[model samples]
Target: MKRILVVGVTGSGKSTLARALSNRLGLTYHEMDALYFDGPGWSVNSELVDDVSRLTAGSGWIIDSLGSPEVRDLLWDRADTVIWLDYPKRVVMPRVLRRSVRRTVTREVLFGGNRETWTGWLSREHPAWWSWSQHGTRRREVAHRTRDPRFAPLDTLRFGHPRDTEAWLSSL
Candidate 1:
């Protein structure tokens, strides 16, 4: 549990759980979204790969997400344990939608100071859309990938219920 990769569909509480685990276990907490996005207007940062490479070069860390495939291998290759928050799609979908709307309406600044806008929320390229669209695929993809022999070095914990996850996390 020293070097962990917290994975799940958006709004499945990846960031929240990662933060808590890091604090409780005294491990470094890295939010991958901060590595990929830059200041206001939500522009994509080119240094994402470099940032992730540097951050994970250490012996221990807990990262929130690996939304990009390029960085996925980097984290997956090094992680000792993976915590998969496999919450129901219906549960996550509503949470993501509500969070997106709240952020857009309140103009909350996120990673690298970027804030979500009403226009972006309506657009097909929005994070909300990405979350919803990627939901099903990610659920299946991560499940299958963890079972492959290539991932033998890693120990994965899949949680279909939040209570089960909490119990595991608490036992440390």
Candidate 2:
């Protein structure tokens, strides 16, 4: 699988799976979060278009984040594979919460030099909130997009739950 794009609702383990795939396949791992969120004030990836171009210009690479809808064609047109980690809320919510708590407790530095905080976790903008609110919509959107005639040439792999991800990854 070359030129892969990993997509899912926020905190659905897209980045994690993409990273593993990159390592296993020996492809360049592009953390779109690092590109989009790597700003001075948590900006919305001001350089998204240019950065995406630069990253995808190569023949092989794995992108962990979906970036923006504005660049969907840029990615889908070039990507040979698109992996969707569409886990259910029951499985994803606790994972997101645990990840949030771990990041907050660790004071981990994320993209844009941002650190997870209790306040941020409680805020509406948090990834957890986004995951909860967008779970169903995101699943439907991904399914529809994958089924679209425009993307018919792309190979889509969807994992409905965490076990599916592990099984697939392990097999690889």
Candidate 3:
């Protein structure tokens, strides 16, 4: 509950949980999307590593994104607990699809001045695509990491359903 790393497939409620965790624990909230995506005409910054390093260097904070292994390791190495939102694909897919549609239709500004577009939603590079493709693999990856001796010392909280996740967070 001190310093947490909230990981999940897109639309699995990572941001929401991170926000609530921040408020409940009185910690800082760091949205990784904002750090990774640059303003207007969305582009990945070369300085993303430096920014992520700076953000995770603090003592008390919650990160809502899972970056590269090197960057993620840096955060997890320092974090006291790791919360993985492992909701079922059927539960997550619809949420992601609806969210994508809403963002595309409304042209909502996110992560700087960047907005999600309908074309991007159709593209394989979109978060929705990543979510769909990585659903099973990501869970295996997290499971392996949790089982590895290197990560064994890290506290792990995994939720197979959103309601269970809510209950766990409520108890925190």
Candidate 4:
């Protein structure tokens, strides 16, 4: 599990797990969002491909999020293992809602120094609604993608519940 990819819908704990796994395994942790969003604005990072390419050239790394399709193609082919946080919407929505509220209320700056606004939730672009709207479709898409023959060489560890992920982390 040297080169690991942690993937999930927003707020599904991919970043948390990726950080933990990187710490436990002593691998370089690369938060993809940091590479995808790098300033005080919403523009996509143009250096994303170069950043990912540089990381993949190394022998070990653990990254969070399935990046843009271009990056995903490059990442998935090189990653040795993929940890999928497949928690259900029932379990995920509240967590996302709480996180969204906390980040908004606290004005926590995220990737690109972006802060969530309560009024922002009125749109589907908000993390809460994005997670809510994308959860099912994201689940199906990732599941099907991983099943392809091209990805057969990649190891997959999927967690449907928090406890399952906790146990796996503990085991590691």
- Tens digits of per-residue lDDT, candidate 2, 62-133, equal 997554786778888788899988788888899898998899999998888888888887778798898898
lDDT of 3 by residue, 1-172 (tens): 6778888888899999999989888999988888777776777767887887887788789988555664777776777788999888899999998998899899888886987897797778687898999888888877787776765577888888999998987887
Model 3 residue-pair collision total: 0
- How do all the candidates rank in terms of TM-score, highest first? 4, 2, 3, 1
Number of clashes in model 1? 0
RMSD to true structure for each model, in Å: 1.5, 1.4, 1.5, 1.1
Candidate lDDT values, in order? 0.84, 0.85, 0.82, 0.87
Identify the runs in model 2 with alpha carbons over 4 angstroms from their true place. Answer: none
What TM-score would you give candidate 4 relative to the actual structure?
Answer: 0.95
Give candidate 4's error at residue 27 in angstroms: 0.4
TM-score of each: 0.92, 0.93, 0.92, 0.95
> Which ten contiguous residues of candidate 2 have the minimum total lDDT?
64-73
Which candidate do you rate higher for TM-score, 1 or 2?
2
On TM-score, the candidate that comes out on top is: 4
